[model samples]
Target chain A: MQPFLPVYAPLSDQQIKHIEDMADQVLAEVGVILQDDPISHEAMAAVGARIESDKVFTKGDDLRALIAQAPRQFTWYGQSPECDVVIGEKPLYAPTYGPPVVETHDENRHQATMADYEALVLLCDRSELLGTTGSLLTIPHDVPEEARPIAMARAHLEHSKKPMCGSIISEQALRDVAHEVGTDPSKCHLMHMINTTPPLVIQPNPLRCLRAAVELGQGNMVASYMMMGATAPVSIMGALAQGLAEIMVGLALTQIYRPGAPVVGGLFATPFEMQQMGPMFGSPQSQLVQIAGAQLVRRLGVPCRGDGMLSSSKLNDAQAGYEGAITLAASQLCQADFILHSIGWSEFGRSYNFDKCLADEALILSSI
Target chain B: MQPFLPVYAPLSDQQIKHIEDMADQVLAEVGVILQDDPISHEAMAAVGARIESDKVFTKGDDLRALIAQAPRQFTWYGQSPECDVVIGEKPLYAPTYGPPVVETHDENRHQATMADYEALVLLCDRSELLGTTGSLLTIPHDVPEEARPIAMARAHLEHSKKPMCGSIISEQALRDVAHEVGTDPSKCHLMHMINTTPPLVIQPNPLRCLRAAVELGQGNMVASYMMMGATAPVSIMGALAQGLAEIMVGLALTQIYRPGAPVVGGLFATPFEMQQMGPMFGSPQSQLVQIAGAQLVRRLGVPCRGDGMLSSSKLNDAQAGYEGAITLAASQLCQADFILHSIGWSEFGRSYNFDKCLADEALILSSI
Candidate 1:
């Protein structure tokens, strides 16, 4: 089935403009803090941005011009030529990322083992619905944390041909993956997750990953993972403006470092439930953020990332289905390009349940 | 909380007009048949509609003019003034209707007894979320099938003061409920489900109920329940147009019988799964029909009916969640009024699962 060409854009032009203006204000005034990343600071300085301590204050117009160097769309190569995927065209689905637990049945959660990870990779490989083989379906506790990224990359190369994301644990992890895959620099062969610390900060590790991945001629997805009411404001538009400012800093860094770098802007915002002091997923408020974020990112002239079936529900029950459907429907309606956590997400990114995955896939197939 | 005022319209004006044109063609040419109802046949003939046996062939414009007599909105009074509900202003939620089985836990289904029916009424009465008490959450096997409607109505009135839908089994059942409730003609005190037989026909029972309900100054919801690909064409727009034509016949009948009758137009279209020979609910295709139907009914100048949390899953699982959410979200997005089956529906309306009801209500509460 063809990707959705939405006739209804939820955000009005004026509303979109207000968000852009707010983001620009944050960029020029609040600025973005980059920790322990000299290359990024130097690049921003070269672009005539003012630097105070670790924060780089820049005109939004200059950042926009630099970000224009990035390609609007790019081809991501798989292990084989036939598996290549074109980003910024259709929603390229990938399975759950960064879950630490696993379950096959209700309330039967356990620490995710290497066996679980391999099983997920095998399951994802066999499904025609998923366009890319995602990293970190779960953190296999058996594997040492540092070596896990390399282990994952090797497994991707050894098992599946679909495009895979590199590890963001450290710059070396990304480099090792590139070497293991024998990545072709002339063409983008890998993608990596680079998250910005919320409320107006970019941590050192993500900064290094962004610069390193772009330099290696690979794609980067700059994700702003904010828990609203804690790291960001409780107001929907307020949190969105903060998220946009942070992502633009990362996107602009890619272009300033290397003209025409492949990058994706992602806004993964969920409300902070005060009662639990944790982030809530698959709420209607979050769905609105996804839809508006898609519209804003599209105007930013790059591919956007959205999550599928993100749920707070523990079981593969009615709660999970409704939450996941609304979230996925938001992405589908807005025509999001890169969809992460497309299925099998449970408990606010806590577990990867196999049964939930099958249920999600069924929903996807029926929709198509 | 305010109901959804959608800024995004899934259908273009041209598309909507195309459906309208198709419906008009069906009304003028193929027409609609009324079975064993001479009053309806005589009423159509009085309006200058050509009566060929039981079928009424009237120009679409004539039907539209007749439908104009019904109010765009109406107030449905509860037993007390404080519990009264205004239907066309917001999505007034009513629980699952017309299921013959009950399940409190997974795989523990049993025939619904009168005690189960009373328990549902008590559960609904205590809830602040449900706007009205709905009839036939499950059929009580202890009651005679012919007397079931009156029993259900008495249970609703004795337990809750909320507005309710009257029985649809027979005309006598409706009159009996009205007499028991001591319905006032000055106010719209009761509503009845008046379903149009699919593929351009209206059964005798529904016609009699519609006439009786309107004459007593009560409300009638004209629902077209079509199993697409079997009863109507398989295409989304085709099924939608056919549904629209059928509903128009029922709506026009209400107005012609009594000007300013309280009425709702409902389009309930689920695909007939060819393999199973059963209707499938909660598919994205059905959601589209719901959304488009909402927009069309708004143009026809009456409140629209939409089902909430309708699902085909036997368990309250992830399939139920996603399906329920997507279906409910469609109604929410379109700001549909008079929502029936707002929670606790399962297996194509076969059972009213109590757990699913709570799960579905949580979703509704969180959204609000």
Candidate 2:
């Protein structure tokens, strides 16, 4: 991993001040509503917030200000002069592999392997992408459960020069990976997802993952994916606000544990088919709401992340292109600071279709 | 506008070296065909290239390697937290406005003004945009021609904290406004439009303006805006590639003068109206071609720029939204690093429509 990552649209001194004030107001008055996770709830309470079941409230102005202190733009190193890319201050393009990793040199979804990781690097290098995800799209097969994080980090450091972000299954994994990446446990930017359980509640594992990522000094790209009319409110905006609340509460918790902690807020919401019980992408409204969520996060003056080449109907066909284009277009228009799943993505984050990834890279590159 | 604003994709060190070698081969064997203006021809001749009329043929590899040297990203300054945005490395959002000079303000069709600029700042702040163009559509009544650039730059600097791209009009206007805003000329990202002069020709003034901007050390964002079937080839891709070629020649000239200059290559091609003898933005092919052009530019590896809220219809209505969304969506999806006519734009960059700009911002923000 590179020693540093680049940032864009830096905040002014006044903006920083405003964010601090807002954070305090949110912490003191608004407070956060955590799910039914007593451990996280206790952690929030320990950090000077009042706890009421899953709800945690306190003044977090200082925390907001500190996180807001994260520079708007900075340099993230690449392999050399040619590979170096500035992310925030400029538009950076990265291609991603879709879900259900394909075995290297074969057709079949399986756990990711080192060869898959290497293929990703070569593809990213060959394509127009400024970076690669190391072992993107959930490389479950490559490493043992206990050693996954460290293995992934080492792969990135050894195989690629561009910046990469992803999750570690556990705290030990996070620590091991942090050591391998040489990032301060508290300042790393690892990706994680947060979803509502039945009836709009965050699950324990993801909840703990969110807090742990932040507490350890690694930035959390907290994704709040709400399926409208299922685990979330029926309306897209309603679902968006709810998702925002979940991520914000988690982010607020991290900032409290350690002020000035780096964190990125994100949303991965879409529509759900009641009859089929399937998630739907390509809904214009779904994309709209996701973009709106991105704006809402940015409004809070924090870096926001989003996916671009997202598709629900697993095939890498016209549906993928149309949905991916719409999704990528919406987020880019909304000026998402960081984009995950920008390329080689399809089938609801399953199946890394090479052609689709290449096409998506073209789309992502065009947007920047 | 350094001597050369080479458009290039991010390449591995080996690839860069390979391209450099290729460039050397081209420089010594196959060469570039420099067509158009005599000044450029003369400039190439001085560089030891063969000239035919306005055409200059050079060894291809030298130019290729020179272009490969361009930095993948650079910093752009913003006025406030709301407006702070970047281009080059990542896609940045900017707003469009109605043309105040030609249009009147109303509930639906609002004219642009200083107040409109202020409103734009608020909306831009609320939304996720990288930078802004003052008067989004065009506040002709708000500021005199002499003062337009200053007013726009000043508003962006004062109201928002985002990096801004320089305005169009005249070279002197650019310098004057840069002075007014106390911006260093070297850091400015200047913009201009190139219209096809029917069949195959280039106008002198806009060309001069582009060259002047480049000479001043300001970044150039050039667009070839064609009204298809009338001003350009009927096929959208044909028009797109031709338009890209037109700009590339000019861009190549910039590089010849200054190596590794910051430049954005862009295309804005729309279908033409036979009866009205103008252009229409409602066509979907224009949007698709725009997306394709973005791919081409990134394939070439220079920063890509284009428009969003552009329309040729004289009014702001559903046609506007549909067309604007399509175009803007393409722009964002293509990951255009810098976007002009992104907000408050209407009638194909002819007037200021604040309401339309506002709606575009809202829609774009909420877009997926």
Candidate 3:
């Protein structure tokens, strides 16, 4: 993969600095609400953070300093030698990470079964564009809830030799996947996705996932799916500040757990359509926040994870095409290091269509 | 309308200079073939350009000198006062200029009727994005070939008060439309599109159309639709040079016929796919040529006409969406002033769909 060169940055350096300063202020004043996580609170306290009840406050410098200890780039290994992937070299594409439903070309959506999950794995394996058979292609309704994580990992191991994301469901579940795959901890075999709750908060489950993955010398991705005017602020600047502050807190956790942990920062913002009461992707404001915020993420000296080929359209029609194309182009414009959900995402990431996946990857192939 | 600022220029100053040098060399050496056009030959000789049979040769400096007299920007007046469009200020969108086939949302294609042509006129009038009524939305199969151009112009005048393209089929047809609409030439009420046959040639018919429009103080657009590796040189630099030279010869004619005439330069190049034996849109090479070539056209001191929302896809699917979005984004990136074929174009500009038009425009809305 050739290195991505940013060509469509809309914000000035002064504007970026202004947003960064706001993020710093948010971290210093409002603080992140840590939910009943003593280990996280203790880690923050050890790093000289101010804590009250469930709120943990740290200066931006403290967070940045902790984040600085994390490696800016690293390599992830698969069972196969050719499957090794360099995280920050260029735009690395992965399939849809989370979707509960599958939409076919004929326009029928159904609960994604285990077969559908395995099919996506094979599709990614066959694709020339995608590197990893992404983690959590969809939730498998067929698998028993308790045994699902391990079964998913087993599918990854048996189906293909490509790198996959370990389950962040539980510390034990993730540990079992590592053992099942027999992957070396020294070679960062997995990138555990840890989603953050917005408005300056991180759940304890994801916190535990981050710590477990970091301690094992694996990659941990901190991401927030924000809907402006809803979960996030209406203004791009306000949303960016909150988004940046949220991600920084999560990044700080990786270094606090273990220095030099491989980590990626993702802040995906889509404007909330007031009339529809849902997220709207591929808007100009969405593009602005993505390009500007990714620049902010890079300032912290780490790889920024990008969301790609996302659309609210149910069918793989023109709406899906434009939305996917526009969003994907924003990733390239900002030169986002690791692109997640690069293909096969539709209905606002609710349903994955096989045809849309092929069509989107073709678009990506044409663009870059 | 907001003035567009170019943001995605990929060519370096040296590279632009190299292409310019190549264009200059081509014009001085190969020359443009002006077939059976005695008046054009006389105009070229008057400008001290060398002429041999149908070939007209002039130095790049000589061509640039003549082209410098054309207006860089102008106000095009519609019948309604609110419909005034300032060319070169921002992107002024228009509908599909030419397509003989019409495809509907139900996935059916048929020969375009007079009803389809008029429907497109009304669509453009209803559109908030599109400024002009556009030239030829589609060829009317019901209308006689000889009377089609005047019939199209009449539909634009009768349906909407928007500024529209004058008939360029002949010198008399254009004059008839100006008189029928009762439009004053001083206000630049029309922009006539005159297509250039590729491989450095402009047929006499279009030359006559260009001359008639320029004589009446109306705008003239000299555009070439070239397929690289077939009608044009395989290399982007080589294609760009040939494109610029072809356009310069036409732009120079506008000055020789009537100095300070408003003109636009369009050089649309799509790569020729070997297996398909047709032009492919949305390719990275297509974007580079569009952006770099538009910059070269801007250097000639006229508004660069852009072809937008173009695709070779047969359906209003993801392929169409990506291709249209990518191409439209290129126009915005290069800040092309007058955007033609901005919506409803499909199947390599041979088919137009109502659903695709609305969908493409929505994509543009989400983008800018």
Candidate 4:
């Protein structure tokens, strides 16, 4: 089937150009902080990037050239050939990831266990709408920190045949998941999500994971998870510029590490709520950011990644439905390539509800 | 603001042309039953319509000529100047109309009284999103049948500064409401909804109301309320053809009654659920119909009318939110000019929930 075209563009071409120029300026002048990662600093210095202590600066032309080397589209292979997905051709859906709690009708709230993780993987496998099983639909609290990645990967391998993500917490965790799944990273069976800290900073662990993934030739979804009005600029264009700068740095690094590496660029941010003293999700501002981000990614000739069916509501009530529907619809209309958190997300990604997950799957199919 | 362009088009020009041609054939060959109304029968005969008892037939060219006489767009004056709205330029929202029951947080459901009607009118008046204080948001059972129109009109006139609708049960009711509101028919303040009984029949009361509205130079929303697979054809295109034929007949009658009258066209229908033995609302099929209907209305060079925030769920729960959001988004994207049942519809329009009404209003404002 042909890919769905964007029905709405939140930013005009002139506005997109202005934001792109600003992003380039931020990359060249302000630079990005490579926090506690001397390896990244050395790598940047070797690639003609200027290194001044922790800050690494690169010109817009250099970043663009590196970005141009990355593949515009790539296929992520699943265990079954029928489950493989072409990343840049259409909007692919994945389940909500990294939630720490699970909510069911019997239990109001409980720490997610390995059993819950396996069940969720099974659900994703059975769902016609979900394209990927997703990594960490909820954190398995019963599993020890050292062995969690292996256990999660085993659950995914055993219960689902869909393409799934490898752990990004550490280099070892990423390797463990790939080895357990019998995935050849050179062919890129598993993808990894590397999130940058706000205000143009890449932490040591995430940077390490990025290097490991690139060296192994695994796909990467590089993103900046910033909170506007707090860690990033409050304005939409400003925040977009900052986000673009961060993601571009990460993406450019992937190309430098291994040219023609498969990577999806992401821009995910939320406006900070002063009263709650936290970030809000499924908001109109965030939705606009997602739409504008898609436009930017399209301009860069890379696949765009963002969340779908995201909500801050605690229960699967009207608020959850409205918020989820709005965000999901926005993602579809914006022509996002890969939609994360496509189902079972609640309470700012803290809790995953089973009934809501089922309902959201139906919603996704209806939309298609 | 400029009108919203369609985000989705369910029918292509070729398909629409085919449907229109089929509709013309239906009108000229099959004819329509003008039920139990001698006045309408005589009027149809006078206008070169072939009448045999109750069946009134006319060729496509005559109907087209009559339809061409009606204005493309007109202003609907509200009590306050700021509240006055241009009918065809953009989507105009109106509250839910003609529900006999009301639901609240404390009560499951109860018979609606005059108090409920007045409160709803007041709510619509205060709502920033609602464009019109819709007629009979809930049936005022306390009001006697003969005085219902006067009571409903008074509630709207006294509580709201927005545009509203008049009664459509009888010609007397239409004139009574107009006289009570002191509206000049030439510049219609109150619009009337005239529903045609499918397949291809206009009952006596609605025909009488239509004639009265047209003769007085008032605006009329002529529609075919069809139940697909039951009262109309099962196929979407076939149902659309039948609906178009019915509505065009009413539109022609309005033009024949008084040329250059303000009018809006509507195509409202739902697919029948065989097991449930009822029509389902807020379904994906209905949303598609609405989008295709908007394209049809646009081609006719007239404003389109439909519903918003419609749901089949009994409770204002996740189902309600999802269904309502899908339909509402579809209506907005389709560029419906007059969105009736804009808020607080539930159980397929059998009951109106107060909480849902408020939430739906907020949803509407957020979209803008």
- Individual DockQ of the candidates? 0.57, 0.03, 0.46, 0.34
lDDT of 2 by residue, B271-321 (tens): 887987777764566765666667656655687875776655566653454
Residue B316 of model 4 has an lDDT of 81
DockQ-based CAPRI category assigned to the predicted complex of candidate 1: medium
The local distance difference test score of model 4 is: 0.84
True contacts kept of each: 0.79, 0.03, 0.57, 0.33
Q: Write model 3 residue lDDT over B288-363, tens digit each, in one string.
A: 7778878888889999888789887887777788777778877887888998889998887888888888878877
Query: Per-prediction TM-score, chain A only?
Result: 0.96, 0.78, 0.96, 0.97
Error of model 3, residue A67, in angstroms: 2.6
Candidate 3 residue pairs in backbone clash: none
Candidate 1 chain B, poorest ten consecutive residues by summed lDDT: B1-10
Candidate 3: segments with Cα more than 4 A from true spot: A1-6, A103-109, B1-6, B103-109
Please provide, for model 4 over A15-119, each residue's C-alpha lDDT reduced to its tens digit, 9 standing for 90 to 100.
878999999899899999989888888877887899998999987777878888888889998999999999988889988988899997685689999988898
What candidate 1 gets wrong by more than 4 Å, as runs, is A1-8, A104-115, A140-146, B1-8, B105-108
Lowest lDDT 10-mer window, candidate 4 chain A? A1-10
Q: lDDT tens string, model 1, B57-116?
A: 888778888888888878999988899989998788998888999887565799999999
Score each candidate by Cα lDDT. Answer: 0.85, 0.58, 0.84, 0.84
lDDT of 3 by residue, A159-199 (tens): 88888899988999988887887767688999999888987
Docking class of 3: acceptable
